[model samples]
Target: MGGESNRWAASGRKATAVGTIAFRQQLAYKTDFALRGFFLLFILFVFIQLWTAAYEGDFDKAISGFTLKQIVWYLVFTEALTMAAPPLCSRIEEEVKNGDVAIRLIRPQSYVGYHFSVFASEALTRFAVHLLIGSAIAWPFVGPPSFGGGWLGLLALSAGALTVTFLLLLLVGLCAFWVEETSGLYFVLQKLQFTIGGMLLPIDLMPEWLQRVCAWLPFQAALYFPARMAVHFDPALLVKQLGIQIGWIALLAFAVNRMYRRGVTKLHVNGG
Candidate 1:
């Protein structure tokens, strides 16, 4: 039994190693990733131009909180941040629906850990690419954001925001165990987040009630809160938002673990 467990542990490490290698392999296609990044930069430029035109004359002086240049820079940061964001939750659901997850289940390793390891590896790779080349291009065109809070607080809040986003999506993916076909549902959810996640516009720019609603949703923590941390450095607000992000991460991680176990049981029962 001890020997068998050792072999199992070795196999798990091998699988995770393969996943890490595959992440690098995907990133090696520099042409594709660069093109995608370029498109993002181009889109930011177009939006900036439109906003610049709109803000001409009296509108320029009248606008209060964010100047035209600041808004342009916000678009730059928004593009970089969104590009670095993880893939949609639907990928895991697709794997389950297509029975691809069965292959992983046959291994001695934990399926949840394996998938998350793969995700984390890919996210790290992408983030590096974004910070290096992507940021270089965007930063020159637009100045860095003026953050109001302490740097450490903003960093902590950003970390919490990333954790919350990952956990929420993991929970969403685990829901596929019961729902079977969750792509359609995720599509609608994605649309909602795109519209209300405040990735496209600052929640502060929206109506008071809309901002209140955004505050409660997990989607806001995903992008808006982190972006706020980048631009506004209020430690008190950062602490409050970080607390919310941590709470969501904890709750979602627990919920997803339960769902994952239940799903595995169902898979075994169904003999899939």
Candidate 2:
């Protein structure tokens, strides 16, 4: 038991190191970082204009339980979360096609863990950057962000959302093991996330039937719940949302693990 515990601890340290490396790699690409930041600003500016028009320049007007300011803030958070996600599916598919995954598999760390570390690091870095850019742009227009649930709650929910997103992307990427291309699958996944996942519009603002449908899907756990919680957090709702996020994360992680195990067995390596 002691030996097993030590092995687990070592794995944790390795994952952290891998994540740190990935984070630094992201920062190394200054051009890409600047472009992403600019793009985030543009997106926030467009959303601000659109939402302002929708509210007819009435910031205090409430639409579907969300004041214009709350809606703008919600969009800022949602868009940041959405844009922060790297093209993990495409990266995984490419690695699988080029046999890079075989090299990864031979490494000391678990292939899935390595990918998860990289994905989490990249996503968190981008998320933070996008959030800062969006917040800075949205602040003068929308005033301050709602702090109904406190910063800790927002951070916790954001972390859960990112984890859920990574697992889902991992599952989609692992499909490359069987299918020659996963881009179409990823495209569909992205659309679902933007539409029903609450990135494009809050679930509460959707039609009742659509809202009911989103409630059953895991997409909301990744986008809608966290964004909504940011704008109008309820303590009881936070507990419920966290519980749901945990459930989705558990299920998605299990799927990712199973897929990786089965997929790796089918992996073919050539020329060392």
Candidate 3:
């Protein structure tokens, strides 16, 4: 038991180190970082214009229980989260095609753990950057975020949302082990996230039937739940969403582990 505990501790330390390196590497690309922030700013500006027109320049007008300000803020969070996601699916597919996974699998750390550490680190950094830029652009037009005391809860939920997203992407990437091309699958996943996952619009505004369908699917846990909580926070809602996020994370993580175990067995490397 002691040896097992020590092994776990060592693995944790290794993951942490890998994550830290990934975070620093992300920071090193100053030009890319600036470009990402500029892109986020541009997106928020466009959304503000669209929403303002939708509200007919009346920021106080409520649509589906969301004021114009709240809607913009909601978009800010949703877009930030969406843009912050790393291209894990494409990266994994490429690695598999080029025989890189063989090298990665021989490493001391778990292959999934190594990739997840890198994904989480880079994604969290980009998320923070995007959020900052989006918030700066939205604040002048929408005033301050109304969820004043719930900032910590918002951050926690956002992290959970990202984790769920990462697991889904990992599963998609692992599909490369079997099919050898995952771009079509990844494209479909992106569409699901944009529509049913509520990255482009809140599920509340959708038809009741669509909302019910989203509720049954795990996609909303990655985008809708956290973004909705950010703009319209309730302690009870937070607790409920957190539970939902946790459940989705566990289920997706289990699926990822199972798929990875089977996928790794089918992995083949032809060239040096």
Order of quality (lDDT): 3, 2, 1
Q: What are the per-model numbers of colliding residue pairs?
A: 2, 0, 0
Q: Which lDDT values do the candidates have, in the order given?
A: 0.68, 0.87, 0.88
TM-score for candidate 1, please give it: 0.80
How well is each residue in 160-254 modelled by candidate 2, as lDDT tens digits? 99999989888999999889499999999999999999998999889999999999999999888878888887889899999999999988888
- Output the lDDT of residue 22, model 3: 93
For model 1, state the Cα shift of residue 195 in Å: 2.2
Number of the top TM-score candidate: 2
Q: Which stretches of candidate 2 lie over 4 Å from their true place?
A: 268-272
The digit string of per-residue lDDT tens for model 3 on 41-121 reads: 887898899989999989668999989988898888898899889899999999888889889999999999999899989
Off by over 4 Å in 1: 1-19, 57-64, 88-90, 106-108, 131-137, 146-154
Worst 10 residues of 1 by lDDT: 57-66
The lDDT of model 1 is 0.68
Query: TM-scores of all models?
Result: 0.80, 0.96, 0.95
